[model samples]
Target: MEPMGLRERKKLATRRTLQHEALRLAIEHGSENVTVDDIAAAANVSTRTFFNYFSSKEEAIIGDGPPRPTADATAVFVANGPTGDLLDDLKHFILSPMLDLSAEELGYTFTDFLARKQLMLRESHLVTRMMATFAATEREVVAGVAARLGEEPEAIRPQIVAALGMTALRFALRHLHHHGDTAEGAGAEGARAAEIAELRDLLDEAFDALRQTFDTAR
Candidate 1:
């Protein structure tokens, strides 16, 4: 990726400060007791500034939700491209956001992911907020699936396919949460390729199993 501009870097730094402070305060105290003002105070920013970066205290603690599919990626899928098969296309479409930076540039390291997983597990009360974010992401997936099929977003086909893709993703994520250290020791996208490839491999296995299950029933 190109170097971030000064404004972008400052914005990113501010967001990271809020995230780091929010996580620290929540872990030190209790998430239920940690209000937005408290987080803002801890970060040395006004509540308005805090709200500028995150919608709520919980949002800062959980970090950003899943990235959206790029317009180009969605258009390609709608045009039946990158590959023609539906299952294959869907997998790539969903994973594309994570893989956009290329293998050497994939920045989301497994160690970071594992740490986030542990935080979520440790603070189970925040699951509801996380789920709400996930629901929004699922809706995006459904919209893309529906568009590709020339159907309404409410169509069952879109919902089912979206759920299946999410299932494989969750499977891959759960595996990574536990075994991250085994694959990549963290830092740099170059070292993180194995971690992401593992995610792709697990997704492949999951979809393959589903395909076999359905084929045998037929």
Candidate 2:
């Protein structure tokens, strides 16, 4: 992959600083209490600049997620280099991107994401907006996968397959938050890595199930 332009790199750095500051402040004070101005000040950026990156305070705290970490895997699948086994391709695409996150960038505890999820859930308005973004992203990913599989993008089978994949991923993330590196009682990086590994295993199993049900049925 090509290196990021200097300006793009700087922008990413600024965005990360804002996100990190926002998360830290939210963790320290309640999410409700932290204002956009406060986060901007913490990140050394103007409040308007914060708006340029995120739509709202909630988004700043836990929005604009990590870029798809496994694009290479997705590219391989998209190219149909493996005879178009969508399930296998997806498994590789999904898991491989995570490996790209630097250790420090990957340092987030599953527990923290869980806490943020819970907190965001309580904010129904923000939750609603965030869900819209998620849904749109889901469809885009599904369409991309469907295209690679030579399936009609709008076909029920492709949509259903995408839904199943998404559900399994969600379950895996929840499991990580509840029992793995993100267990409520733990806060260490070691625990976090273990949780991530467990989540990956679960995803792999889920993909296996998907393949068995779909590929075998066909």
Candidate 3:
């Protein structure tokens, strides 16, 4: 809701820089050949600074990612909420953390994110780290949904909502990957806006499909 302060933006910028360089170096020289020192030097930051943002080069390549909901957003969703509609609210709760922030604001574009994903596919070594990151993200979603429902995290309702939310996100992203708006000039504002719109529409379709499926079952 509130605009990010200069400090937070600066930190995000640094993190983005480190991640971009790490990905770039790994892609070029191969992840096996690249070290923390190489990524840090490429980013023009010291190894110590790199370590502050990421535990290792592999971690940096993954980025501070999957971009979980902020505490503020999660609290609002748990309490007041943007909307009382369960599916709609859960969609917003899961995606607003990303949709609310522009790619430029975060110092990383959607295209950059896709590039990181491609790197993960190329580097088998990063697979384990990526899996752990995804697992942590799922838990966070389950916890947020559970808190809102006043249910334990292991409860079926929270688990189902969390699973639906993640599936919708992945579906939207996969759709985006096939769409061409992001293939070139993704740095342009119009391209970025189109990408956002595409992702939002696909997510809505995915959730709406879920609603339809369940409504028919009922």
Q: Against the true structure, whose lDDT is highest?
A: 3
- Expressed as tens digits, the lDDT of each residue in 176-209 for candidate 3 is 7433344366654555566667777888999999
- My TM-score estimates for the predictions, one after another, are 0.81, 0.76, 0.86
State which candidate has the highest TM-score: 3
Better of 1 and 2 by lDDT: 1
Instruction: Give the range of the ten consecutive residues with the poorest summed lDDT in model 1.
Output: 103-112
How well is each residue in 35-121 modelled by candidate 2, as lDDT tens digits?
Answer: 999999999999899999988887777755423524555667678745566676665555555566544455543444666676675
Record all residue pairs in model 3 with backbone atoms less than 3 Å apart, i.e. clashing: none
Clashing pairs in 1: none
At residue 129, what lDDT does model 1 achieve?
79
Candidate 3 or 2, higher TM-score? 3
Supply candidate 2's per-residue lDDT for 115: 60
Residue pairs in clash, model 2: 69-97, 70-97, 181-195
- What is the alpha-carbon lDDT of model 1 when measured against the actual structure? 0.76
Candidate closer to the true structure by TM-score (higher is better), 1 or 3: 3
TM-score of 3: 0.86
Root-mean-square deviation (CA) per prediction: 3.4, 4.2, 2.9
